[model samples]
Target: MIPVVQHQWKGNLAQAREIQVFLAQKVILKPFKIKPETVLAVDVSYSRFEKCGYGVAGLFKVAFDNRRHKFHIVSEQYYTNSDTVPFPYIPGYLSFREIPILLPILSQISERPDLLLVDGAGIAHPRHLGLAAHLGVIFDLPAIGCAKSRLIGDFLMPGLESGAYEYLRTNGKRIGVVLRTKPACRPLFISPGHRCTITDAWRLIFTFCDQYRLPEPLRRVDLMSKRMRKQIEKK
Candidate 1:
């Protein structure tokens, strides 16, 4: 089981931002090779019933066969819990609102993944730590953040052709990439979370993209989370 550091979730906005600033310092940016046999992606879906909300974390794994240079789903897991959201929906502090729901899912996974991908920003955040970076530091796992929209940083839109990209720059430093995963589709904001550099994260995301705009493992978990919410709501 992956060890989860014990931390409280309830806090005010100032307290939440302070924690992010502290954890942001712990994020590491270094080059590392990421040939993985297993990769995991996680996402959470929320539904409300009266005063409480149900949050379900959908964790999906993809295994790569080196010989074939292909990837396929190996397993999927889901963990659900209901609670009033402890933190308000504030910019730059999403991890505080979402991490509590995801930790149980991470701890209960059948196999630890070689890498973890999250559907949010990493070091590309205003505080240099988003959901991916936060979880990566807490777990000390190799993680990457692939966000659908720009959270911070300036970038020129990448070319329409798939695989095109432009660096996301902040004060002349490249913090992430605006990666075009499919022709004519909006680019993904890619950033390193922990234990990997920007280039390492880019290459891994490109390899797993295959025929879709989003990486396969990340896409799978997103769908899984959305479907889980639908099923739960129907009951």
Candidate 2:
């Protein structure tokens, strides 16, 4: 079981790095050599019009032998944020507001996923570590950040299909990868959150992708979060 430790603050972003280091130290890090049977995609969605937001997280169990990959999604957890908005959408300090509600639901899932795909930049941040790395360090789960757009990194256009990937560097470290998931689709920025190697991150991203730039698990989760949030507000 992954224990979650979220540091609350009085609207301060200064202590983010310290708290991240503490969380990274709290968990026992491991290097899993591929062979992971299951992968989960996590994402949060919000409507600025409604001034509301929600997160959707789930386990997408993938079975592989020597031929093809099969996926089965199970136990998706969805929830809302603390009604009162704490801060504006700051680039590097997103987890502060979102994870507070998301983590609680994530903890209740039965089986901890072998890999996590986050719908945001991972180590491709100004600090060389984004929220994906933060969650991976905190939970000790292998994770990859799959951002729809570039947060911060240098890369060549990896083209519009699988197998094309470029390295993303930040803080003098090759911290992220930009991969093309579909033909003629926008490429995704991928980075190691923590524990997982950069290679494994790319494999997981392609494993879950099915005709979309974003993986299926996270795409479903994002849709779920948006729909659920709208339903809650309507209620």
Candidate 3:
């Protein structure tokens, strides 16, 4: 996949914040018109002591058997570059720290995914541009953010049953949802990144989730990234 917009990844904090504000305007919230047959999930694991990061991108084919959806891995790619992380760990500027490594892995995947599931925030962010929104705008693809924790929002606890969810709002405007993917498990913060609406984001994530707090595709890539980081540490 190629980027629709180009911008420098390395910059000071002020410049980074400016870029987020500028790009956030380009995020398009609409229905994803296609029935996605394939999805690509991307995640990064940092070795802070080594000042390096490992990124993994996995492409999974969506399958339907017995009226239930399943995701099967089609291909997986890892970033093996030795480039030292250029940016420090900051709460709001995650795209700067991880996107450089992830883009290369994304480019390596031969088949373009119908949807992108990111393991981070989207418009739920304070600047309205998080890692998922940034990537979706760059690729011009429909993407969703499935974050493990809330960044900025006020939400009541969802019901204990699976698939239960509550709206996550900021200043009286809904930005995302606090979703319960599994019974009695911690909820996930989900939002539209770009080219999709809030309802679409939560619905898709709920469908992909099975017996786990995270959706299957995202869980796979998260494990892949952590394994890659462990391998590097052993070396």
Candidate 4:
């Protein structure tokens, strides 16, 4: 999809931080959740060489019933792209390094999703504009961040049960939630990217997980990215 708002991507750490500060102001934490008929999950997998990676996006049509509170995946579409990383990976500024490689894949998706689930952080970043937030602002679409690890902030461990969560705070402001997606597994860090609220992100993340620690869309795309990267490297 074409970005609704385009901005330069190549920059130094200082410049990246400045962009983050500017974009963070645009992130809307308001409750913008909808009964989405489609969702897209995206992830990028790196090769042994840090400067090359593959990106994959999976768009799925879904049906959700409030009475059952269940989501059924009706259909799926996939897209993939490989690119040479333009910048070195830096903590808290990962989007700068990865987004350049991922956008091509995102732009080629056959269908636009009602919601975008990013395999990264949102307001959970030190600058409050992580990968998800950055993409949401650029796309002008609702998005959520479902991270495997905490990029910043501190919180008590959530209970050892599915759906348990605790608020993650930074300087007395709530930024995200530590949500348990499966029993006896590590919890995910759920955060609002843009046009979505913390609670909405949490609930949708739980619904997407279905029976795994990672959401189904994320899981499938992660595997696809890895496979794509390997195939590209072999060529």
> Which candidate number maximizes lDDT?
4
Displacement of residue 146 (Cα, Å) in model 1 is: 0.5
TM-score of 2: 0.84
Give candidate 3's error at residue 185 in angstroms: 0.7
lDDT tens digits, residue span 31-105, model 4: 874788888888988889587878888888888866767688898888888788888878888898788888887
For model 3, how does the per-residue alpha-carbon lDDT over 1-235 read when each residue is reduced to its tens digit? 7788998745789999999999999999999877787888888888857498888887777764436754444445443433567788799999998888887777766676789999999899999999999999999889999999999999999999998999999998999999999999999999999999999999888888888889989998889888888887898
The window of 10 residues in a row where model 2 has the poorest summed lDDT is 77-86
- Candidates in order, TM-scores: namely 0.89, 0.84, 0.93, 0.95
For model 2, how does the per-residue alpha-carbon lDDT over 1-31 read when each residue is reduced to its tens digit? 4555445656666676567555544433345
User: In TM-score terms, which candidate is top?
Assistant: 4
Better of 2 and 3 by TM-score: 3
How does each model score on lDDT?
Answer: 0.79, 0.70, 0.86, 0.87
Q: How far is candidate 1 from the true structure (C-alpha RMSD, Å)?
A: 2.5
The segments of candidate 4 whose C-alpha lies over 4 angstroms from its true place after superposition are 65-68
Model 1: per-residue lDDT, tens digit, 1-235? 4655556645778778878888888888877675776676777656653233444444555676677565666776666665655665677888987886676666777676778888899899999998999989998888999999989999998999988999999998999999998899989999999999999888788877878989887786777766766776788
**Model 1 TM:** 0.89
Model 3 shows how many backbone clashes? Answer: 0
After superposition, the stretches of candidate 3 with alpha carbons farther than 4 Å from their true spots are 48-50, 69-82
Candidate 4 least-lDDT 10 residues: 104-113
Q: Superpose all Cα atoms of candidate 3 onto the true structure and report the RMSD in Å to 1 decimal.
A: 1.9
